[model samples]
Target: MSLVRSAGLQKFRQSVEALGGDPEVYARRAGLPVDALDSDELLVEDSALAAVLEIAAADLGCPDLGLRVGRAQDFGMLGPLAVAIQHSPSVADALACTSRYMFVHARDLSVALVEDPDGSHGVVGLRYSFSAGKRPLPQATDMTMLFLHRAVEFLVGGRYGLRSVDLPHQPAAPRSRYEDAFGARVRFGRDAALLRVPSSLLSRPLDGVDETLRRLALAFLSQQSSEARPLVTAKVRTVLDQSLGTGSTELVDVARALAVHPRTLQRQLAAEGESFASVLDSVRRARARTYLTTTDMPLSQVSDLIGFAEQGVLSRCAQRWWGRTPSALRQEARSRARPRA
Candidate 1:
């Protein structure tokens, strides 16, 4: 059984109760020591805890209900840190700094920046990677995602939402919760999960900085560190290659398949100065180039082969990556391929 301090446990129970679930029943089914459940400290098996939460959510007909609880508790911890970073001189620096600070308590997760040639900046994305014996519960990961989504909203004052959200599972459930929380296009059955945001939105200056609050947040982050890497470019490349034929990849599934906590995986990638989304973009660009020059496959088929949601998204990405449309690129390649006549 995994034992956590009572304070944290109580908060979790309260969240469950708020969702109209019976805390005592959940505690019992999750194998919490009866006395421990009532005490200030709690001991419960991780798998059991995960199962209880999942069953509760399913019963409520809201696979994302746990997410709501997580957001309320965790976003409060993250908001000030996000604000501090947002108030930094530029989005680039803000993101870099945020990544450093955000990982202290949440060492399993990571944040990174993605810059297109046109000066558009994306959050790159966030994800978790677990180490061996530390698989994160889906409820836990979902909750973390909720906190992240809400924190971003808090930072931007709700001006925008995520551009896209990717999940590693088949997406049989949690569709509505994802939609409600992210309000963006959701893709499941992908190798690595992602949350994409428009580059333009990153430029908005924050309201102001609170040095005292910022220091507290940074201090909190400073207290923790773990030596795991989830967003490694190599890992991302491998996953993309594997998904080329499947046409769908889920980030959570990849984390599970890799036998690491999703957040840990993300932190490792952040430490490496890369993100899953950035790596995916790189892979897509590389593949596009190769297919344009070496294969006679039509653009649409090529786009699908590379796991793009649509040819239009592929076209836009190609233009951004190479400063030319797919056809233009193909024509250019063909021209170069022709021998002297």
Candidate 2:
């Protein structure tokens, strides 16, 4: 179950009002709580919010409604998540923090740093799904992509020099709305939504990053991490995500951190019809797929990030899993992610 952040909805309401539309009318008409967006802590159902956005847009006679909502969003709208990201050392650190702690915002909102092949360009792919195995509404998607871009602008000084915006669905709103807001080409009906950026931008230290705020936010996020969310399985996944890059995702190490015996952890996982090795493999596959498609990360780095000893190991795994070598997988992924005609 994924929960959406209330801030985006709040922006929708604001945008509606700014355009002389009645937000209350749309809220009531859409079967939503009129004040839901006003509450910062409230986590909303993405599906319901999507429906509301669609209805609100149509009711207001605004095709760029979602784009407006996104363009208006600021870092403060992200609440604590914004604090954490803003205070981080650099854009890369911010993205890592987001990936680690995003469960608090949305159950399945994923933000990642994807470097392009040969160290050319990199992108940050923002993928959000309210429910498992289901895509989110087009309005919601547009709002999120644009809002995140704005958030980046607030963090840095410029537009983050975005290369393009890759949207999964065809334009529900006007194409110019996206292009104007992004200041970049807008490609629709792609495989996923991403913000293409320069690889060099990831390391640029954010100006005026408050160390105190960053420390405080990190402490808060530690207590509220995904580990504390649902089950032991969730904790394991979180640990795996954090440890993969270090080449240390062993179950024993994980269980040791939890202060549990390896056997005890194994037994717990077995009760859920899973195993430590299985869980590790699952995490690896998920990370590998994201890296292969979203980034131009070299195969060697990808191998290291996913806990393979070397590049060939990752190649073997890819061959077994996707029936394609790493290069082929990357090619196929790029092809799929390309905008449709």
Give the TM-scores of the predictions, in the order they appear: 0.49, 0.62
Q: How does candidate 2 score on lDDT?
A: 0.74
| Least accurate 10 contiguous residues by lDDT in model 1 | 1-10
The backbone clash count of each candidate, in order, is 27, 3
Question: Taking the tens digit of each residue's C-alpha lDDT, what string does model 2 give over 134-181?
Answer: 777788888888888877788788767777778889998678878998
The CA lDDT of each predicted structure is 0.59, 0.74
Write out the backbone clash pairs for model 2: 115-296, 116-296, 117-296
Residue-level lDDT for 238 in candidate 2: 68
Q: Best-fitting candidate, measured by TM-score?
A: 2
Error of 2 at 194 (Å): 0.3
Error of 1 at 174 (Å): 6.0
Task: Kindly list the per-residue Cα lDDT of model 1 for residues 1-341, writing each as its tens digit.
Answer: 23222222325666666665555555555644333333432223445545666666766576665566655554434444555665565444566776776543343345555432223355445443433346455665565555656666766667454667666555535586677767776776654445566766667665665667666756744544444322244565567657765745556666666687878777766765666676666666656766876689998998888887799988898889779999998887677556647
